[model samples]
Target: MVDASGRQARGEPQGELAGRLRALQELSGLGVRALARDTGLSSSSLSRYLNGQTVPPWPAVVALCRVVRRDPRPLRPLWERASNPLPAPPKSSRQGRPLPRNDLPRDVPDFTGRAEQLAAVFAAVESHRVVSVDGMAGVGKTCLAVHAAHRLAADFPDGQLYVDLHGFTEGRPPLDADSALRALLAALDVPSERVPQDGLEQLAACWRAELARRRVVVVLDNAADAEQVRPLLPGAGPSVALVTSRNRLLGLDEVPPVSLDVLSPEESAELLVRASGDPGGPEGRLARDPESAAEVLRRCGHLPLALRLAGARLRHRPGWTVGVLVERLAAGASEFDTAFAMSVRQLGRPQARLFRLLGLLPGASFDEYVVAALADLPVRDVRAMLEELLDAHLVQQPTADRYRLHDLVHQHARRASAEQDPAAERERALGRVLDYYVHAAAAADAAMPFLSPGAPPTAGRPPAELPPFADKNAAFAWLTAEYGNLMAAFETAAAVGADTHVYELPRFLRAYFARRCGTTHLNVLFERSLAAAERLGDPVRLAEAHSDLGFARYNAGRLAEAAAGYEAAGLRVAQAGDARVAAELALRRGYLSWDAGGVEEPLDLFRLAGKLYEEAGCPAGAAHAAAAEAWATLQLGHREEAARRPGRCWTSRTPTPPGRPR
Candidate 1:
């Protein structure tokens, strides 16, 4: 291939250019973070460039070459070619696509009431191709949206997609617009390399473009507001979207919405009986005691979730009359309290304890292993306990092995745990959860080490066992799935003054963030970690924290703040007398200096780093520093002197380094 500069390139422009740029990075012997620090590029962006997932701008290519003293002019032809590759072929209009995706959660079998509301949703969809269902918590917003999507399935034959935005989920933050857009695009089979890494507007445009060529239905559940759901709507297409939120989404003026309320008294009575499986005969409990049945409906507040829990309790007890159920629920004030308290009261002590502890869980949903950790029980025993909770309708089994509590139920459980469990017991349970995540994250980080050449020592006590990660892929999958929960754990630990955990947890997520999430969240985490480290007053940890914060700032292009961090870290490292940390610090300091436009000072820093690494018995680190010095020498046009350094450096590590693990 040839560019307008009339220079010939070989192989695919993007892939080949990425390979050559990667070679330059290897020649300097710097990890991805180190390279990004010196190049004034975000680590996430640089990672994407090096992995051939994205094409860097011309200036970025020049920056990389300048660091290693490679001639940028020679690579310009290839960079130009890569920058303007032919666009992808247009997708056909769903004529021969794969089988339709059915990601909607299983529709409730005993779906009672909401007849008018369902019809309203259908009417809105017919007019706008988008309709939102808004209601209070536990009022069946999600149920209505999913039911409508399933019923309208034949109209949009391409696929059915579902995304739980986690707007009001306990412990987890609302899913941001960018992450939500990425999920929606991925559900439509968009390739990762094709998806934009930054810019919510760009991702949304791509999502709309993709949807325009197909007929599909998407259920966007638990949206925080209109801004979160607006970008996900289809543009001028037969495809439709159904959004569910607790509050009215006034911002989505183009999309009609159905405002839902609690079931009518008659509808509520019918639902309670149907869900309880009481026969129509006079011999049944509902028929035998009309007054008590009405009381049960009142106690449930005519809400669907509360009614289901109440019905499940009655269905499981054959001997109990309607009056007995009412008496058990008579003490609570709110519908959630009445229904959730009665259901939780029926569990054995062990199961009840597990249910209460689950309230402390920080993720949107969890599997049995996390349950085991939170309850400090054996995994096998935890499975049976979770089954019992699911049977009581206290916990929702969204998927086969993943479960979550309804929002109202979660609030009730949290309240009950605070009332019943002691402070120390609650603290210990949450500590176990922190330990579980830190240990598992560290293990997963180990299996798929990123540009982490000088990783710190792992912290936190490990649990009795951890889920096995068969390979890097499996490890990453686990990390991605648990990311929200892990963040929640970090926040919980920090809030409770678990300083050690607060400082240690973010260390494992750096590589993950560099690949999937952007630097914004990573920067927040390291900032908090820095605070926790200072509180602990451990010089080594404090120094590491400063260095980590500096690295994050450097990636964010905050050079002045990054310099301040590095200076503080140097003082702490000197006090701690840790040669390994001192060497890493020196190496990073050198990169920062180089990026700040100093040619000679950075070389001196590199030499000092190599000497310190040698003294610390870290041959790899010493080699890395030596290579950095050689590259700086070459950048200064001292080719002969630079040639000798690599002969020694090459023996310590592989010459052709692999791409980022992610």
Candidate 2:
């Protein structure tokens, strides 16, 4: 007999009879029309009987068995069983209708973050008929949606329906919209026979009709896109559809989307504490060492999935500290790689390639042009691919034209790149980016005057098609934007033994670093340059490198190191027969003495530097030395002695500005 949805629901007798009929048909090797002729029955009627859609009379069953050369007596009992009606549900349980299926997952008990997001979802559910929640994989989109749905369940008395669309699932394709519609319809208590199975539109119509007068809550979780979610949504009614996806689903109409970011550090720590099982036990220890706790959160990328896993790990290991977990994560241990892989696996080949290359990029963020250069693709293509990544939440664009991978995503990309891309290919890609920055920074540096005029020039062919800088301001702005990246590039080059790049980049960066007052990075950059220069064993280059390092160290208030750097530069300059640079170093050392509050020694050193500068026919240098000697005399509280001893230099020069030697 046919069930309510028009599909066959056969009892044991019907199953046996249908099995005998099908065997007879196959043994006879006849079509339905031929079988009908043999049985003197209409083709449609015989087909229904054989297919178990309907039961036939005893005479018809016998006729079918006889046609297949079998006795009908053995099938009588089977037919009797098939004719009996199926049993009904218990009277108490089947009073009126089935209870509303509350298939929503249990809310996360330690759901520590997203107070604002929860509030927003609550507010949106009140005003909007549909709410879309989207974010990176493992950022708690599903958890947040479930929590919100549970809170809003009372508002919708009809029922709550939940479905996992399997979007971005590792090995399976996303659930199709038609299948999803059938599922939603089934959840709404539509009988199997009545639920439309032909077209998505028809199924959608049935779904809407069911929810039209009711107040149901639908949670379509892990959706593939707007297309998959659109038909599943109930038509305008008291019902609410809460859709969650890794994709942004921007194409959905009038559905206000909420994008979830990683939890704040405070929230992350709180989550860790709560998820630890013993909130006051291990959490109390974490509270005491806030810095280490923060490190643990950072290692987890402040993402809920990672944090939960870390917390679980900590809970299992009672003897382990938060710092222990942080160390493990720092040493390349990760639990969220698979979660990230699901999203990356959804990208097209080009987009995937761009993402891997992004892992090799130097800094936290980059623009399209840098991405293009790194991937060796056209900028237009890179932009389009980046948009795809952005939509997938694999990358984030915090500001216009600048994109960055989340820290955990970056780690995944790096691991993927190392595993999938050849070492040589990665090296080449990194080289291209480093070369670009070196030439680009040099171009920017050219538009700005040197901070220290005596520093040596960098020797390299200008890279072609570099972005133009209209003036010093534009150049400085570009440099400022790329400052961190440039520093990273320098560090990368040094690590790879690219000595020429290592030594040359700082020479170009000195002006910008000084202008920006970036003493900390300057010190590190120049120290790296000195090491690279020493590896090359070029005395003049070493002299200039030491000079740059000395200035950087002096600015950082490392006077002893600064003095040693200048002394090392003086020795190099003397070996290279650069009397002018030697004189400059002597004057710098004299200024250092003055800075150390020594008057007589600086006075003597400045006098010697002045005579040497005069011998080199550098009048400005001699005048600077004289001015500094007079300043030293004034520092000794002998103002008259300072004025008379260096009258000409004092009359011609103003007091040296701060951070500038006279």
Candidate 3:
């Protein structure tokens, strides 16, 4: 309610506070999306806050106030009251609630023959509230799990959630338990501020608490092992979980295991008939060519993935008889090979070449841009070819616009590429891929400038084009999504003795690691990059590697080792005479000194850092160094001098002293 003064009445604090926030946003003259972009918030969440549906977090309120140049301290009491409002009625008493979330992938229309396994899955979920479906690759573990989830969707009306743990994927590491839990919680529409940023147990507890209130079915697909999936299970509720893995999760003793095998010969034949849309009974192609049909089935090993691919080939080429398919399979050395070979042979040369080169891709899954880089083709051309490959069943689109090879298909592509493409050509293609990642990562890093903004030197040919990142969030999203592939690229570079790439690539990941990942992996990457830098015999690069290693060590709390790395960097950087690197080294050394309890030395080093940064023409670095110096002065009991400093210091950003990189 508003008074004659057009101000909120004394009561209704939530409404008053929301009105103030809305007024602040109006003052800023930005639309909802623009304000959200400026405030680092999702528009949906911001909308809720402005409409009084939810209390904005303190930081969010502060961000909003900052955008409008208003003092937020005046609003603290009202915010606190709004945030601590009376508890609402229980879920049982709530009315007109939203429908449950459903993220399950579409069920295969021709999902054939897993009757006994499907029954076992339902029974296990009923009894144990969890089921682990384990089998060999391409035996339809994921298919059966997804199918079962779709079938049980009505029973678990709370929601259906799905997550791929990326276990047994060719190049990507399995998703860790913490990340998996966060994904689960996010799918439940939990606010980002509510999710714990650290601690596996805390995240798991939060997930359990949320699940306890509702009946949801979660599919933890492509899990690496029991340990990875253990924390993702619901504790006590109508909610249940289904896990699928290539290896049997023997460690999940409480969860019943349903092991799948290749389809039986009869089932396989039926699947082929269904997949190929062949007429049933004595007049069908299989009935006319029994011997060849058996050969096709044998070649497929009755594996669902292989069978589907083989069946697709036959379906697409109606003129070809079973005997002709068998003749194509004869060229392959193995049963599995025959199935894949037949499908691959149907592709046009460019599509076929792209298929073969996809085997050389280092990541488990990739988007079209990366594929374009790998195949040295236009993205439009790659998209068309990918469609062709998709139809051939040579590639699997696990998600929209992202593709991967079935393990069997991956092996076949590798073999075929090796036999056909020359070694030099393969290396060149991989080099192009590495170059694309380096430039892309550099571009992303540029969007989100870290303490040291020096670009890493690219060693391979740059791609014809690169992906665009519009803002820090866009850059961060790209980094998070491509982290696994970037790691794989680094490893591939090291394997091929691409020392320059090995040394340069990890430099781009420092900011990402500090945010999403911790220092352990960062330390490992810098360690490897340091070795690469040494191999390349470039003093400036070596200094950068050492400085980066020191930063990682410092973040990981290895102060002594960090000092050693800084010392090494200092020596090498002096010899190279790069002003930017020298500035970085000085700033890092200042941080090291401050961290090690040296008062005067740190202040001196900070001053030197400030001077070098000015020389390097980096105002951000200079300001950071100046702030460090001011903070150190305050530590030395020179409060007046520290207060007189021109720039504001962000000492509260870190728990420790003023030693963190800018």
Candidate 4:
């Protein structure tokens, strides 16, 4: 390809790179002709180099690498390619070629259990070219990330790299995000650690420069948070990143949430059967009983670690049946916790304490509540707790105000509680919640008497010193404000065997009915209240609840059901011989029959109910009944007949046309 001028006279070197070499000679103080003279090359050949016609050979390259003091190894490939570009390979088998021997660790173990999660991670690898797999510890977040990165080998030609951030591990001081960034920069084949000491910006620019178009995948395992991941991002979308953490990394506002729940019953069993290798013999019939499998899964809380442990136990003791394992698990109340303990035992003491304290809180799905409750100190006091746990992926803060532990984490939390606190401390932690609810309820109940107009506030200090809601209106206000929360507390107390709350809580909430909070809300939860009252055998509470339920049902328009419920209440009331309540329920039942109107004797029933209400001195009931009769009479196309009940018909409040008291 040489020309008569001893250069590429006929079509040789293409563009920019050729120009750069010529600039290199001028800048390095090697005047083109003098450069040729020093290397014993022709002027014309040197001119061609300067004019960007032909790239010079190795003698020139050695000269260049020496002047720059950089490892010329990087530019060598570019130089050789320009000298003679390799023919583009044919399209027949183009995929997953390894990086040129320097991109990753010697071996990355295959990660199992979280297949769907791994698949999603891989899909992110495939689609985003940049992905972060974030979740809590023993949720197998990292394992899934590793597998996803490996699966995406085809996506990235530049290869995969891994780093353990040690964010959650005890005593293993976490590298500042910048230090981690430096390590990543070095991994990308950047020669100098002269990476920026301050901003990760320069290093990230270098990373993009290094990985640009190379298509690498970086598994930023155990990341601290977004500030950590953001600086490390190559920005070259061709590169994929999967981050693993206990923190929700809500810090990365852009990434969609890929929440990892404890495995489902079926998923857990598949893990067990696959990991333990068959519940033994003939299509593993032992594994096929879904109930037993579900029980086995439940014992493990369907978490991966416990499932893996159960599977491992079975694998070692091949003769054990699924039922035997389930029993062992059922007996080990800390079984899931035991499984996570194995993972945590690998951690240092400080981390273990943090992990344990995280378990001793009042509720599942916690937040700052967890920080204060478990650590038994302010979130401010436990300086790096969130970061530490986040790195380990032990605590998952998937959203604002929402933090979840993997079921495995809950298991670990139980274990953590036993180790971190004495039984008394654990009880104390639980007692705070109990006492808070009890006192709060006492306050609300003390306020309840005020809800009914003109009902002088119940005094005498409640015999329990329950706080006053200032006055009666305050009681109703408190009840109204805390209705849902109070109900939730009541349910919790009831579940924990505090039957006093089970009986008394509903009475306090009876005023809740006025809000018309909707039948759906009642239908969902109040049936449990009725069942609790019945189980406790409280006739008074039961009668009141049934009456309230009947009224609720009637108001909500399940008329026949309401009538049945009121009749049930009435039977109980009549037996107790509470004449006023008995009379009211009786009127309500008769009115239900009249309004329903399938019977021909509706007028008779209404008149009788009206008389009963009047005898009981409930003008509201009498007025309601009178209104019903007039409405029914009008419905029968007898408006003239409807004018008959004047004395009973809010007569003190209305005048009649015919003046008939009939």
Point to the candidate with the largest lDDT. 3
Residues 326-363 of candidate 2: C-alpha lDDT, one tens digit per residue: 66666554547744554566578888888888888866
Task: Write candidate 3's Cα lDDT for 1-662 as tens digits.
Answer: 34312323545668788898999999999999999999988999999888877667556787898898886767865876675555668877576666788878778778988889999998999899999999988889888999999999999898999887888766456777866786678678775656765578988998999999988999999898889988999998789999999898989889999999999988999898988878879998888999999988888789888788777878899899989888887887876788888887787888889999999988777889898899888888899889888888787786786787776788788888999999999988999999888888888888885554675556787787677899999998888778768888988888889998899898887777766664566788899999999999989899989999998888777788988998899899989998888888888887667545456787788888888989988888888888878866754445677777755454432211343672
lDDT of 4 at 94: 57
Q: Which model, 1 or 3, shows the larger TM-score?
A: 1
lDDT value for candidate 3? 0.82
In terms of lDDT, the poorest run of 10 residues in model 4 is: 451-460
Q: What tens digits encode model 1's per-residue C-alpha lDDT throughout 263-347?
A: 9998888888888998867888998999999988888889988888888888999889999999988977777898888988899
Alpha-carbon runs more than 4 Å astray in model 1: 1-102, 154-159, 170-173, 182-214, 236-238, 451-460, 557-564, 587-662
- Stretches off by above 4 angstroms in model 2 are 1-137, 140-350, 376-385, 445-451, 454-468, 504-525, 558-560, 578-587, 593-662
Q: What's the lDDT for residue 605 in model 3?
A: 88
Give the alpha-carbon lDDT of every model. Answer: 0.81, 0.74, 0.82, 0.56
| lDDT string, candidate 4, 1-662, tens digits | 44423433433333444555665676668776776666566888767655666566534555544554544444544554565554667675355442442333222232345667766766665565556666545566665666666666666766677766656643123445655665576556454534443345665776677777677778777776777677666675566677777788787766644667777666676777776767444568354565777776766777666677666666656576677666666555475654455445545776677677656443434445334544455555444666556544466664444455654566557666776678886665554444444455555554544211111122111222233468757776555434434554555566677655555455444444433133544533455656766777756556655665676566556787787787778667756654445545554555455434333465665566567667767665566656666655644435566667543333322322111111
Query: What TM-score should be assigned to candidate 2?
Result: 0.43
